[model samples]
Target: MSADTLITLDTPTDGTTVSGSFDAKGTANSPEANVPWRILDAGGQKVLHGHFTAEGWMDKLYPYAGTVDVSKLAPGSYTFEVSVDDPSGGEGKAPQKVDRSITVQ
Candidate 1:
């Protein structure tokens, strides 16, 4: 699958600075409309993770929006990533993922 067609993040764009809670909004086309996400510290250590369902799926890309809280995390740079859920467990092609850097204050 083409990387560009897999997913797109619209809010909290790259190099953004956020505090407390922030919105994560984007569009994605993946199995069962499942959009899994994670936050990693600069050292590449996972800090937060979870999954959220899209508004719709199957025929085309659907919108997904959710809130991520960083109030408990220490102030620093981190990576926010969203990946397509591949239930095939590698039997199919590799999953697609998109990530961006952000600074938490």
Candidate 2:
């Protein structure tokens, strides 16, 4: 993913198989700091939830590095995403979500 995008998952690229816990580093940008993230099962249930932290997150592009904890999940397919909250309760501005599918072993 490019630094200019809204968010990017660098490790465990899409459709990659993995096991246990692994490093998950990516870049994200929100209208604010610390955009939330989650790992979802194939059924779309949230399994792991967390947020991204950057040195600076002021309506600009930034990097968020963290580990994706999947040690407790059974072998299956899941998805991960980085999301941003809606900028106020107004029209035309809604939450942003980006996701990719992965396999667990």
Candidate 3:
């Protein structure tokens, strides 16, 4: 992932395979130390969504980690995404996000 992006996913990288529960860790510059994330099925349907708090926030990029349970999901392809929305509600900028393809097996 590019360092320029506000969020960077370090684990379960692009095309990674996962099973059961997996850890998603990364660095971010998000609001209130809240890092939002989601998993979308191949058909573009949201399967899971939630947020995790980072170790720190505001002044710089901070580390964040969360465990995503996928045992309930059917084995298939999915997109895992992490993003930081513009706290100002898009007054003049867009949200920063990063995503990668993952397969549950």
Q: Which candidate is the best by lDDT?
A: 1
- Stretches off by above 4 angstroms in model 3 are 1-4, 86-92
Model 2 regions more than 4 Å off: 1-5, 86-92
Q: Could you tell me how far off, in angstroms, the CA of residue 30 lies in candidate 2 after the best superposition? A: 2.3
TM-score for each candidate, following the candidate numbering: 0.90, 0.78, 0.88
Considering TM-score, which of the candidate structures 1 and 3 is the better prediction for this target? 1
Give the per-residue lDDT of model 3 (tens digit) for 24-97. Answer: 99999898888989999999899998887888887778999999998999999999999884668779677788
Shift of residue 100 alpha carbon in model 1, Å:
0.9
Per-residue CA lDDT of model 1 for 5-63, tens digit only, reads 87878987999999998899998987899999999999999999988789877778899
**Between candidates 1 and 2, which one is better according to TM-score?**
1
Q: After aligning candidate 2 to the native by TM-score, how far in Å is the CA of 56 from where it should be?
A: 1.3
Per-candidate clashes, comma-separated: 0, 0, 0
Best by TM-score: 1
Decoy 3 TM-score against native: 0.88
- All models: lDDT? 0.89, 0.75, 0.88
Rate residue 17 of model 3 by lDDT: 94
Cα lDDT tens digits for candidate 2, 1-105: 555567666775788788988777766676666677889998899998987675456576677777777889899999987776446755665566777788999
TM-score of 1: 0.90
